[model samples]
Target: MKKILRRLRRFIRRLLGIKPRMVWLTHPVFLQHEPGGSHPDSPERIRAVEAELKAQNIWRHLQTAEAGEVSDTQLALVHSRRYLHFLEANQPPEGKIYRIDDDTVMSHDSMTAARFAAGAVVAAVDMVMAKKAHNAFCAARPPGHHAKSGSAGGFCLINSTAVGAMYAIAEYRLQRIAVIDFDVHHGDGTTEIFKDDPRILFLNVFEADLFPFPDLEKERGSSPNMLHTPFERGASSLTFRRRIRNEWLPVLGSFKPELILFSAGFDAHRDDETGRLNLHEADFSWLTHKIVQTASSCNGRIVSVLEGGYTLTPLGKSAAAHIRVLAGKGRGVDVMRYNRRLKQRT
Candidate 1:
């Protein structure tokens, strides 16, 4: 009955000239990657985003799809085979967790979840490039920006966005691609992988003196392809927006990329303590609109993969705001008021 109703809904939308604008991809495995012991990157992050979208009545309007299965060949495009072998060979025993580093841990199901996370981005790229949807959002985690080609860190196991970018270049033969990351922490791993590659233009906007790259200040201008823009702690929305317009937009416009990919991380939200930045949902919505506007030149192709947002409430609210814009639904939720209501409930 549910399947029939879904089909009927699709038909009715088509008849009414309501074309679906985006696809949302996720997987069940993402929920099982428990890192244990007070980890902020919990499965509840995904749940929070899901619950918020449903509450906002946005879920019903999206075209939900399962994550694609990424194979060894595709993963090797960005990662080494030996490192891949090590991950599979080193799966912890049942009920035991393996620590990759001080910040990264892997339960038995971690690799499986990581694979699917990368797969979700790959699938999104395919969907957007094929014009099946104007854009796509993959809600899979453990986040991947801090992950290197050979080593995992910052609770990341695979560099999913890098994998997806490489996949697009290989499969579709795209000469120029833009990878834009707005996470609070520098996308050091991604920068390392693509620093020498002229085909990729990496625009990274991150906070200065953060984890994994306290020395990032000295490393600026080392690579021509990778442009690093650092923001001081507690940067205001105006500063961020102005810098993006004055600094990043010109480079993006000049490149005229064939495909655009985003490493979307909401940890920089004002309410999320981890990021310590004063960005609200409105800021995120504004950025999404800018990205959509840029996509106008490239057949409106975009694939956004989730990165970091620890606080459940703001994470959900911010993610929903971004997705709603991507889905071509003008914003309706007042994030400040919604947060106040939740506090009242509590």
Candidate 2:
């Protein structure tokens, strides 16, 4: 009876031409990306996010889809054949853990998780391009913004948003696409890959002196498609919003990208221990509103893939704010509660 009612509701919505949907992509394989104990980035992050969204009943607003693995062709969109070969060669055997760096570690299943994480974003691009859903978010891991073309670090193994943007450009023939990285860390990997490609606008805001930090500032390429806004540690919400408004909004206004892909990382939240700069759920809500508004003006298409939120409590709260906003749900307690929390923390 419940299933019948759901089907009937879908039919009615279709009949009414109310086909708005915020598709969320996740996969069980994402849970297999355990880096080790005491690591900030763990499988528990996904669990916490899933539990909160379910408890809040936000899933009702989302068109949840099981994410798939990225095809080799899709990986080829961003990663090189040699790099793919290197990652495959270094993948750990069953029940074994291999450490890539002081912070990055991979178990046997980590490769699968990384591939699917990137694939989830690629699939979200397909869904948006096909109008299967208005916008989509991939709640997968390990996070990808920190992963470079030939290397992975900062708990990231694959550059998902970068790959998805490339897929949209190559497959869907999208002329201009913007990748907005609000992960509290610079997306050096993404900038590295798409430095010279004018087809992409890689705009970001990150806390200064963070991990996987890029030595250079912005893209030094031919067409100039990248912008970086760095914040000092302990920067308040006012500073955060002000800089983005000044730096990103104008660039995005002019870029008029056909699609927007977000490297949505909530690690900047005040409660998160991984980073020093403080942000809150309300900030995330406002940020989503800005991005949604921008996308709406150009083309109502966005694909947000998970990147770097670690602290479970704040991660869940902030991600809920982001996803709910994407689902067209108004910001709830996040508007005031998290703002107060942010003030307290900072």
RMSD in Å for all candidates: 4.4, 3.2
Minimal lDDT window, size 10, model 1: 335-344
| TM-scores of all predicted structures | 0.91, 0.91
> How well is each residue in 195-261 modelled by candidate 2, as lDDT tens digits?
8788988887888788766554333333378887888899988889888888788889888889999
Give me candidate 2's TM-score against the actual structure: 0.91
**What lDDT does each candidate get?**
0.86, 0.84
TM match of model 1 to true structure:
0.91
Instruction: Candidate 2: list runs displaced more than 4 Å.
Output: 1-16, 216-223, 336-346
